[model samples]
Target: MSDSPSLRERVRTEPRPHAVALLVALGVGIGLATVHWVGLVAAGALASLAAPTVRRGVAYALGAGVVALAVFAASLGPAAAAVPGMRPVAYVAVGAGLGLPLLGSLARAAVP
Candidate 1:
């Protein structure tokens, strides 16, 4: 065996279902942001690409939730910071509204 892992070897070691769930969640985020229903459609399609079970769904949802929060926070915070005398409510709201709810839902669902 090679001391260094090959690409195929690395791939074989990955958790396949976890990867698929992330793709689904990311698709959902992109779809909603772009108003491209096709993205959501694709997300749903890829979701099934994972092992069809509650665990996979929840994992994918959690990954997507985290990505969405990060994206939203990055986008909103800079804009809010640029404004003079802005109370930062927009940034806070984006973090709270989008990030918290999705994460909470996924966390709750993840509990067996």
Candidate 2:
């Protein structure tokens, strides 16, 4: 009795929009999202839109986090190797890197 199409129906029709959304998300995330941690949230929300379902979107964003970590390490240069010695703080930083995006990716469920 629900007015909306089932999840299956929506997923089947998903790809075209995903392609466009992914591009815009990347543009905004890379070129415009310079607000540090805030940018991570925005990037996750945009990446979520590029998936067929909320779960998939979250997964995509999580994968993006791995890329983000690599970029961060690259930016750190030789100092990156010293990260492991930070112990407790490094744990928090890594967790945030993964978690913030997952938190933002939850926005997918709120959208169409």
Query: In terms of TM-score, which candidate is strongest?
Result: 2
RMSD of each: 9.0, 4.8
Q: Give the worst 10-residue stretch by lDDT in candidate 1.
A: 40-49
List model 1 lDDT by residue over 1-112, tens digit each: 7598654334324577446455655666555644543333334333433433546554454454445556655766757465445558656644443444344333333432
Clashing pairs in 1: none
Off by over 4 Å in 2: 1-20, 30-34
Error of 1 at 78 (Å): 1.7
lDDT against the true structure, per candidate, is 0.47, 0.71
Per-prediction TM-score, please? 0.39, 0.75
Tens digit of per-residue lDDT, candidate 2, span 29-105: 53433457777777777777667788888887786566566667777899988998898988887787788778878
